[model samples]
Target: MTMMDALGLIENRSYLSSIVAADTALKAANVTLIDLEIIRGGYVTVKLIGDVGAVKAAVEAAKDAAESFGALISAHVIPRMHEETAKLIEKQKGRPAASPEGAKPTAKQEKEETGEQAKTEAVQEESPSPAATERNEENGQEKLTREQLEKLTVVKLRQLVRERKAMESATQINTAKKAELIHSLLEKMEKKE
Candidate 1:
């Protein structure tokens, strides 16, 4: 069999969880980390290559270990990957890998580190351009986008929740949920206005 005949893939929401999974897989069986893909929304997929049996064992070990750290999106072993699959993997390798979720800089952090030029850049990054704005308007008053909501600090989200008298609901939710709820509330408030 060719070297790329057997493969395993594991996906997780947390980078730390992925690392744990990769580590466990290597220790559990004779496998090597072949590729890693970071998809949007903080999802990461780790690929491993080895003999079919080894790949299966590694994937099982990784699945169990990764689940404990965070959400385990998926885990699977492919005994024989198709030619197209190999080409796709090669294509992905050509592109630079994305930074882990936690390592990414926030708009405020960028602004603080850099000066007015950076502050302007941060705002530009958050704001949709004139063309996008026109398109959004044409679509009949688009609500706050997810990217915009993510840019807001947790404190800002909590404050917005309190303002809308949703403190009771927001109190139990995590920071991400708080940001989403606040964004929804602000949209509703705008509609009312």
Candidate 2:
């Protein structure tokens, strides 16, 4: 019978804890680090692959290490992962290890290094420039009507807020819905008036 490779996973609420777990797992067995997914809202998942015995050992060690940090969410080992499951995992593999010196650049990196910058610039030029807000600034305050503010995209609205010196609320601006962004912009405009 052909032996199948195994997959192990460890999840933690803290990135630091997840890193520690991954390190411990690597040290504990002959497993390979597959990826480290940084989920939204601060959760992180460490993925490892190897023989069943090695993967199980690695996951156990990782779980113990992560639990010591009081941030361990869960840990699991699949003795023989299905091909479809492996494909799904492959699709989510975003955290490839850093390349050693003298390694060739990836296709994506090469494209970015060549034509991506010019393409991005062309697209930006074609869009309505938000530079109008900067030109309308009066005494460090932006003058934008509700209609004008509503017409602007969320990205432009965030930029306007930052230019108006609302640094403390930058995080809120990033996660806010479009309606919230519009409301906040109006409120900031009123405060300046």
Candidate 3:
């Protein structure tokens, strides 16, 4: 397998802009599309892997194309990624090994299995858990609120606060107060969406 010497990334606020970036990147060079991850708040990040030269060229083309559609959030190229980074990327893509050793199934078979697992996991996560419903039930856990922010942990709350920069005043408050501020901010964000 050829080692990918570089990884290019282009993030855009709009999904359509991200698609345009991905198309431009693929057409501009002999690179592999790593993934198009949908981040919070309708943002998307397009990733590509290839030789350094190819990745650089593809990223430039993608940036230009993506900017035409909407605000280009960010763009960068990793000239040489760490092994852990490669492993993480593979995990995210759920790609089977390039070579199936021993009695292992072929790459196509592995991919099909992985794809099915991903779909199943996605469906389960997207649906509200039974515990999160039936508010009258004396389950210790609170029901899932309409904002859905209550289900998230404090760490996730901080991450969202940084992402949206929606509540500047919340940063100075206590943890519980911070969470309240974040919830209100997130509600405003959803309304805008």
Highest lDDT: which candidate?
A: 2
Clashing pairs counted in every model? 0, 0, 0
Off by over 4 Å in 1: 1-4, 95-193
User: What digit string (tens of lDDT, one per residue) describes model 3 on residues 1-193?
Assistant: 2344688999999999999899999999999897999999999999999999999999999999988986699999988777667656776776643432366776777778998999898767755577665442443333345446655556556655665564565544235454675565456555544
Candidate 2 stretches greater than 4 Å from native = 1-3, 94-193
As for TM-score, the candidate ahead, 1 or 2, is: 2
Q: Lowest lDDT 10-mer window, candidate 3? A: 135-144
Candidate numbers, best lDDT first, in rank order: 2, 3, 1
TM-score of 1: 0.46
**Residue pairs in candidate 2 whose N, alpha carbon or C atoms collide under 3 angstroms:** none
The models' CA-based lDDT, in order, is: 0.72, 0.79, 0.74
**Which digits, one per residue and each the tens of the lDDT, describe model 1 over residues 1-193?**
2435687999999888998899999999999898777889989999998888999999999999998986799999888766566556654676323323467765754654577677778767755454543223433543454565566656655655565554455545344475567666566556544
Tens-place lDDT per residue, model 2, 21-115, is: 99999999999998899999999999999999999999999999999999999999988877666656765763222334588978865765568
TM-score of each: 0.46, 0.49, 0.49
Off by more than 4 A, model 3: 1-3, 96-193
